[model samples]
Target chain A: MKSKGALQRAIAENAAGYFFLAPWLLGFLALTLYPMIMSLYYSLTQYDMLTEPVWIGMGNYIKMFTGDATYLKSLQVTFAYVFLAVPLKLGFALVVAGIMNQKLKLIGLYRTVYYIPTLLGGSVAIAMLWKRIFSSDGIVNAILRAVFHVNPPAWIASPKYALYTLVILTVWQFGSSMIIFLAGLKQVPDEYYEAASVDGAGKVRQFFSITVPCLTPVILFNLVMQLISAFQAFTQAFIISGGKGGPLDSTMFYTLYLYTKGFYYFEMGYASAMAWVLLAIIAVFTAVIFKTSDSWVTYGSGD
Target chain B: MSTLAKRRLYAALSHAIIIAFGVVMLYPILWLIISSLKPGTVIFSNPGLIPESVSLEHYVKGWAGVGRIHFSVFFINTFIVCAAVVAANIVSCSMAAYAFARLQFAMKALWFGVMMLSIMLPTHVTTIPRYVMFHSLGWVDSYLPLTIPKLLATDAFFVFLLVQFMRGIPKDLDESATLDGCGRVSIFFRVILPLSGPALVTTALFSFLWTWDDFFNQLLYLNTPAKYTIALGLRMFMDASGNSSWGPMLAMSVLSMTPCFLLFFSLQKYFVQGIATTGLKG
Candidate 1:
C-alpha cells in the first residue's frame, strides 16, 4: 500500500512537471522549432519578402558556391578574424587573469576596472566611441603624431587596417574571458605548485606544466565562444562603415553582408541561404573543436 | 633573497601588469568622457587625457531630442522592456527550474537536451522566420515582439543556471515540506525561491543587461522612431551627412552606460558568485 502511494505521488508530480513546462515547451515549438524549419524551406527559394517563394532547389546554394565572389572573401575575412582575434584575446585574458589572481590590495577595484570594457564592448555606444578613437584626427593618430613624429593612417577608414582596428577592440575587452580564467585558476590545486616549486620549477615552468595544462578546458570554452561571436560580428563593421560595409567592402563581414542583402536589398531567400551556410560553417568548426578536445583537454586528470 | 621576498616580488610584478592593462582597457572610455566635455570642433583638435574646459552644454543638447529622435522616450521603452523581461524570466524560469531540478518526471533528460540544442542555434538563422511570424501575429513594430518570449523559459542559459543552483539546495527540505502536506507550488515559492536568492539576482542582472544592450532585435522589431531603445537612440545620433556631432554623441554614450555600471557594482558580490558557480555545473 505504501509503494502504491509513492507511485501515485510520482505520477502526480510528473503531471505537474508537464504543466509547469507548458509555456516553455509551447515557445520552443512555436518560436524556435517552427522558425527553424521555415528558414530551411526559405533557403531553397527566391523570395523577396513581398513575392511568393519560387522554389529553386539547390540553386541558391549553387550560386553561393560557384558564382559569389563576396562569399569566399567573407569566409577568408572571417577565418582571418577568428584565427587572429581568438588567440590574442585568450592570451591577453590569461596574462591578466594571472596578474589579477595575485594577492594584492584593492584587487576588486582592478577587476572592476578591467571588466568595464567587456560590459561596454558589445553596445552601440562603444562602437560609436571606437569610431571616434580610430577616425583620422582621433586620439590614436594624434598620439602617433606627437610621440612618433609621423601621421598614422586613418585606422577605421583605411581598408588595409580597418579589420585590425576591430581585432584590437575585441582584444581590449578580454575581461570576461579573463574573469573565467581567474575562476578556473583558483580551482587549480596550490599543492601542485608547491610540489613543482620543491622540484626547483620556476614560475615560468610551473605555468606551463601546472597552470596551462589544467586550464585547457576553460581555454577551449572561451575559444569556441569567441570564434562563433567573431564570425557573426555586425555592429562594429556596420557602425564604422557608416552602415555601408564600405571602404570598398573590405570590412564587409559575412553577417553584415547577409544583413545588407536581406534588409537593404530585400533578398530574403538569398539571405536565408547565407544564414544557413554560416550556420553550417560554425557547426563544422565547433564539431572540429569538440572532436579534438579529448586530446588536449584534461578534465580532473592531474599528473 | 628569501622565499617570502621572492613571492612579494612576484606579487608586485603581477599588480603592475594588471594595473597597466586596466588603464589600457579604460583609456577609450575615458577619452569618450573627456571628449563629451569639449566643443564639437575642439574635440578633434585637442584629444587629451583632460578636457580643455568642463561644459554641460553637450549634456543638455543630447538630453534634448536631437532632430526629432527623443532620448527620453528611448530610455522609457528600454526600461519597460527590460523590467518586463526580468519579471517574466524570474517567474517562469524559477517554476520550470524547480520542476526539472526537484520533481520526478519522464522525458526530463530529452527535454533538457532540446533546451541545450536551442542555445547552439545561431539566432540570425531564425530571424527571417521570426519576423514573418511576428508580422502575422501583428506584433511587429510593437514591444510585445521584444518582450513576450521571456514569459516562456526561452532563455535556456538562465534556465540552465537556475537548475544548477536548485540542485545544490538540499532535497531533505522538500521531503519534510511534503510530509507537512504542502503542495509543489507552495514548496517552490516558500522553500525553493527564498533559498535561490543569489541565482535569481544574477539572472535578473543578466536579463537587464542583455535586454538593454540588445540592438539588432530592437532594430528589427521596432520600426517607429518613437519606440526606439536607448541603444537604437544612440545610434540615431550619428548623422549621415558626414558631419557627426561628437560632443552630444559622446555625452549620450556616457549617459547610457551609467545605469548598467551602477547596477553591476551594486550587485557585484552576487554577480561574481553566480558566474563562478554557474560555470561549474552549467
Candidate 2:
C-alpha cells in the first residue's frame, strides 16, 4: 500500500511520540492505574500494612455504614460543609465579582486584597492563624469584646461553633472563584445590558433576568469545583482541630478521617473504602449537576 | 443635580463599599504583621490596629527556631523540593504535552482522555497505594516519595495545561523546522519549547507554589526533624509552643508567607491568566 520510506517515517514518528510519552505512561501505570485497582481490591480486604490482607467481600463498606459512628459523623460533617460552604463561597464570589466588574479605578487593588487570603489559604501558616483568631482570647473575640462589649464564645474550641469557623474560613478564600466569575463577567456582552436599559429594566431586575442567566454556566462550574474541593478540605481542619477531628468530631472532614485511618490508625483497607466512597460521592454530585444543568445552563448563542 | 454629578456620587459610593470590603478582607493579614512586630507579652492583650510599640524580638527568636533546627533549614528544604518539582514538571510534562499537541501517535486520543480524567481524580485515591509502593521500595521517610513521582509527570494538570498552550502554536513552524533537517527532539527543544515560554512559566510558577504549599506529602514523607519542610516545621512549631509563644509563631507565619507574597506580586499577571484560562476552559 505505502512506500517503504513512508512506512519507515511513520514508524519513526510513532517511536518518537511514545518516547516523549514514556514518563506519563510509566506514571499512569505505576502510580495512578495500578494504585487505583489495588485500592479497590484493598477496600474489600482487611489489611493493616503489617500483615497479609484477609479478604472479606464488602465487609469494609458494611462496617462503614453500620458499625462506624465516626464514619457517619464524618459523612454528615463533610456533606454539611459541602452544602453550606459551597453555596456561601459561590454567593460571596458572585457578589464580589459583580462589584469588581464595575469600572472602578481601584479595582485592581481591591482584587489583590481580596485574593491574597485565597492565595495563601491552603498553607499551614494561614491555618495556624485561623486557629488563633478563632480562639477564646484571640483577635476576633477581642474585637467583638471591644466593639460590641459582648462575651463571645471560643469559636474554635466549642464543639458547636468549631465547624462553622472552618466554614467561615472556607468562605474567606472565595477569591479564586471570584476571579473566575470576573472573567466570565467580562465575556458577558455589554449590548445585553444596553438593550435591557433601553427596555426600562431596573438594575435589580436586569441582574436577576440577564446577569444571572448569562452567568449560570460559570456558576455551575464554580459550584461543582467548590463542592468537590470543599468535600475534601483537610489542611484547615487538620491544623485547626489538631489533627484529631475533635471538639467532639464536629470538624472531621471526610479526607481528614481517611487520612487518620490510613496513616495514623493504619487501617489501610478502611481508608481505601473511604476513598472509593469519596470518588463515588464526587462522581454522583458531578453527574447530578450535569444532568440538572440542561434546565438552567445556557451557552452563548454562538454555540 | 446634573447627570455628571450623579455619576460622581455613584462612583464615590462604589469606592466606599469596595474599600470597606477590602479592609475587612485584609484585616487578619494586617493583624499578623502588626502582631509579629509587637512585644511578645502584649500581642494578645493589645488588639488595637496600631501597635503601641514595635519590636523584632520574635523574628530573632523564631529564626533561631526550635530544637536547634533553624528556620533557615526549613526554608532551604522547601526551596529545594519546590525547585525539583518545578524542574521535573516542566521537563516531563512539556515533553508529554509536545507529543500530544504535535505528534501523530497511536492511541493518542485515548491517552489524552486518560490524562484529562486524571486531572479531576483526587489524590486520595492514589495516595495509599503510592505510599505502599514507596514503602516497599524503602523510599518512605525521604524526599524521593515527594519529588520522584513529579519526575514521572504524575501531575496531569501541568501536562494538560501545556498541551492546551502548545495547540495554539501554528503547525507550519514545526513543518518548516522538519524541512531544515531538525529531528523531532531537536524541533521540540528549539522551536516548540522556546515558543511555549508563557506556558512553561505558568507550569513552573504553579509547580513551585503548589509544592511549597503542599503539607500532606511533605508531612508523610519527611519524618526527621532535620528534613522538615517549612509547612511541617510550622506545624511542629505550633505544637511545640502551643499558645505560649504567639509573637514568634506569628513572626514565622509572616516569614512563611513572604515568598508566596513576593511571587504573587511580581508575576500577578501570569497568576491571573493561569487561573482564568484553566477555570474557563475546564
Candidate 3:
C-alpha cells in the first residue's frame, strides 16, 4: 500500500512537469523524431519524390562508395577543410586573444575592428565580396603587384588554391573563437601566474606551463564545435563556386553535394543516404575526440 | 638600457603590432564602402579611399531589385520571420527550461538528454524527411517551414543555455514564493522570469542574428521571387551570368552589412557575455 502511494505521487509530479514541457515534447515527436526515422527508412529505398519508394537496402551506400567519384571527392574536400580550417582558426584566435589580454591602450577599438568579420561573415554580401576580392583582377592581385612586384594566380578560379581561399576566409572570421579564448584566459586564476613568476618563470614560460594547461577544456570545446560546423559549411562554397562546385568541383562541400542530389537532381534516396553517412562520420569523429579528451582536457581535479 | 626602458620598449612594440593588424582587418570593409560610392567605370580601375565622384546610383538600382520585387519587400519578410522566431524561442525555451531546472518528473533525465542530443545532430540528416513532410502538409513555398519549428522549441541550444542560467538562480526565491501560497506557474512568473532577463535578451539577440544570416534552409523553403529574403536577393544580383552587375552588387552587400554592424556596436557587451557564458569553466 505504501509503495502504491509513492507511485501515485511520482505520476502526479511527472504530469505537471510534462505539462510545462508540452511544446518541446510535441515538437520533438513531430519534427525531429519522425523526420529522423523517415530519413533512415528513405536511405534504404529508391525514391525520388515522383514515384513510390521501392525497397533497395544498401544499394545507395554501395553506389556511393564504389561508383560515385564525386562522393569520394566531396569527402576529401570536407576533410581537408576541417583539418586545415580548424587549426588555422583556433591558432589565430588564440594568438589574437593573447595579444588582447595584455594591458594596452585603445584596446576597445582594436577588438571592435578585429571582430567585425565574424559579425557579418555569414551574409550573402560578404560571400559575394569574397568572390570579387579573389577574382583574377581583384584587390589581392593588386596588393601583390604593389607590395612585391610579383604576379599571382587568380585564387577562386584555380582548383589548387580555391580551397585555400575558403580556408583563409574561415580564419578571417576567428572572432568567435577569439572571444571564447579571451574568456578562457580571464578564468585562468591570476594567483597561479603570480606563483609562477615568484618561481622565476618568464612570461612565455608561464603561458606555456600554466595558461595553456588551464585552457585545455576550452580548446577541446572549440575544436569539437568547429569541426562539426566545418563539415556542414555550405554558404561559402555555394556562393564561391556558384552552387555548382565548379572550377573542377574544388569547393564542393558535403552538404552542398547532398543538397544537389536531393533538390536539384531529385535523387532523394541517394541524398538521404549521403546525409546518413555524413552524420555517422561526424559522430565518429566527435566520439573519438570525447574519448581521447580525458588524457588532455584538464577540468580541475576531484570532481 | 635599464629594465624600465626595456619594458617601455616592449609595450610600444606590442601596441604597434596590434594597431597594424587592426588596419589590415578593417581594409576589406573599408574598400567595400568606398567601392559602393564610386562611379562604375573607376570602381575596378581606381582602388582609392576617396572616389572621383560620389553617386548613389548603386543603392538606387539595388533598392529597385530584380523584376517587380523591390528589396523592401524582402526586408519586411525577413523582419517578420525573425520577430516570430525570436518571440517563439524566448517563450518556449524559457518554459521548457523552467520545468527542467525546477520540477521533478518521470523520465525527466531522458527528456533532457534527448533535447541536448538534438543540438549536436546535424540538420542535414533530417532535411529530406522534413522536406517531404512539409511538402505533404502543403506548407512548402512559405514561411511556415522555417518559423514553425522554432515555435515548437526545435532549436535546443537556447533551451540548454536558459536552463543553465535558471540552474544558477538561487532556489530560495522559489521556496519563499511557494511559501507565500504561490502556485508553481506563479513562482515561475513572479520569481524566475524576472531573474532571467539577461539570458532571455541574449537568446533574442542570437535568434535574430542567426535567422538573418541563415541561407540554406531559407533557400530550400521559400521559392518565389516575391518571397526572397536579403540573402536570396543578393544572390539574385549575383546569378553567375556573364553580365553580372558588380557595382550595384557591392553596394547592396555594403548596405546589407549595416544592420549587423549597427547591432553589434550597440549591444556588444551582451554579445560577448553570451559567447563567453557558453563554455565557461566547461
State in Å the error of residue B46, model 2. Answer: 3.3
What is the C-alpha DockQ of each candidate? 0.57, 0.66, 0.61
Instruction: Output the lDDT of residue A245, model 1.
Output: 71
Interface Cα RMSD in Å, per prediction: 2.6, 2.1, 2.7
Please report, in order, the local distance difference test score of every candidate based on alpha carbons. Answer: 0.83, 0.88, 0.86
lDDT of 1 by residue, A36-118 (tens): 89988999999887778999998888988899888777777767777888899999888778767766889988988888888
- Between the candidate structures 1 and 3, which one is better when assessed by lDDT? 3
| Tens digits of per-residue lDDT for model 3, B129-196 | 99999999999889999898988899888888899899999999889897899877888889999999
Candidate no. 2 TM-score: 0.97
Q: What lDDT, from 0 to 1, does candidate 2 have?
A: 0.88
Candidates ranked by lDDT: 2, 3, 1
For candidate 3 chain B, the 10 contiguous residues with the lowest summed lDDT are B39-48
- Measured by TM-score, the strongest candidate is 2
What level of docking quality does candidate 2 show?
medium
Top-lDDT structure, candidate number? 2
Best of the two (1, 2) by lDDT: 2
Error of model 1, residue B24, in angstroms: 1.8
